[model samples]
Target: MTTSPRRPMMISAGVMAVMAVVSLGGLVFDDRILLGAPIWLKPFKFALSIGIYFLTWGWLSSLLTVRQRLVARVSAVVIGLLGVEYAILITQVIRGRASHFNVSTTFDRLLYLIMGGSIAVIWTGTLVLTVLLFHTPIADTASRLAIRWGALISLIGIGLGGLMLVPTSQQRASAVHQVIGAHSVGVPDGGPVMAVTGWSTTGGDLRIPHFAGMHALQVLPLLAMLLGFLARRFPRLRPDRTRGRLTAIATAAYAGLVALVTWQAERGQPFIHPDGLTLSAFGLLAAATLGAATLVIARGPAGTTVPEPARHTEMAR
Candidate 1:
């Protein structure tokens, strides 16, 4: 079989997908709970997320030159690190203990050390990969911009996750706390849970921006591509600059939205309960975003047409 840059990532995705299924099955068969969730549920969600991440990262990496061996090695490291984390999480769950913030025993402390170290490595690898992609040339200007910005935003989200461990005002901060409680703000961690995330909906949850920002890698690229498609259907916007500009505005709005929500959460405000001031803030942002989008997209052929960007040179596998 021929080797390719995407091969390692594809393999990682497949393996993680299988693990996701196993964890899902465990949810039904094992009947266990640790830290307010069915033990397997954490692994199930994580496995699926990792599977998708590998697939996306692989695709993005393939776009860069010299991506083959370098990307493969990085992918290997990432997969290995994630695997260790998954194992530790599952092990702790099986022991009916929380995987994170568990300093209860020597074994738990060791496991925590291992997990934290592995995560640090993964974060560094991701940052390195993002930097490589940012420098790589892509003739498709909008796509290149999208990928770079997406990766940047994703890194910010990862950094936000690191903040969760800072031991500053952890929800329900108390004596028994091994570390910081990652959830809740005005209230405790285990109190009220939202449907999907099981995070406290009534309190500030850092996961909102963490969730939105991480997906920028996926969302921005896809949105940029969609604008390209739309441009084709509408000849008036054909200069490519229009589409590119529109994409940029949208990306800015997306970033702003994440920031706004994160700030709101930091204030210990429930996402569901936005006061008038919050509503006004959101409205202002929305209006500005829509106005910017309208200005860019409404331009016709009469508008100054920028020189068409060079066509993308597909990276050879």
Candidate 2:
């Protein structure tokens, strides 16, 4: 059976609306709305948000044939699971209940393994979906390129986020302490006493780097779309080998730049240490690979025979 094209948009809109309401309500009811939520509930909320986003994508995927739909659904499930796992771990950290190895116990280890596997599955599944969609009939080349690039950037973000999970030894000197000491944010007795910061001890700061890397998927793809639109004025530049090559080069360079930033973040000492650099690097590498692949795709001769569309009883209007 086929699904409606509008469903994805509808779901996305609905979820976003709900989230807005929830956020607003939290703000109105509690001064510390962010801190007010129960530890476990926080992850659930985060998972729900991510799940909704992926679900929208899955809903969009349903616009394809049965096989494609199956792939999309499976991918959505994996993404949803990863979202949930992320939420849980983050919540644990927020609650100050997390350990170096939260998955030290057998059960916890199993769960962690499952979550890790789900993440890998989601990444692979999304890439496969991207490839499948690339060949499918679409209204415009720009949209097609947008989708492909979006998927590529998303994979980069996921890669970076994953890398943040890898543990590293802390710097002997604490940057946080130094900053607070130098600034004299508050001093207890003799000299500047190092304030005990909760989040610093945990991996909360790592989120910054992960988010920066992931955001590129949104930023770069939108920029590409804008470029594609501008290129319309210049007929000669449109849909050519050179443009495609340039796109590849630009994307690769963008990824490489992100990697450099990630390296910087990962190299810092103490609280002054750069967080998210490693993850950002991983993200950039993933994007670079995708860029290389896109270059290969765009370089092929024109007028290649199209693949047969998988059987669909009815096509969405």
Best by TM-score: 1
lDDT of 2 by residue, 1-317 (tens): 63443354345446545654664454355443222233333343454446444554544465444365556466545555654566446544454443123454555555556666766776776667656655566443334344456556656766776654544333225332111111111111123122322123211233334444555545554555564555455443344443445555555565665556545534431233335755565576777767775665566544432223311111222
Model 1 stretches with alpha carbons more than 4 Å out: 1-5, 67-69, 168-177, 300-317
Per-candidate TM vs. native? 0.89, 0.53
Best by lDDT: 1
In candidate 2, which residue ranges exceed 4 Å CA deviation?
4-13, 27-66, 79-117, 134-146, 170-209, 232-246, 269-317
What local distance difference test score does each model get? 0.75, 0.47
How good is model 1 by TM-score? Answer: 0.89
Name the weakest run of 10 consecutive residues (lDDT summed) in model 2. Answer: 177-186
Model 1 alpha-carbon miss at residue 314, Å: 5.7
Give the CA lDDT, 0 to 100, for residue 316 in model 1: 21
* Model 2 global lDDT (CA atoms, 0 to 1): 0.47
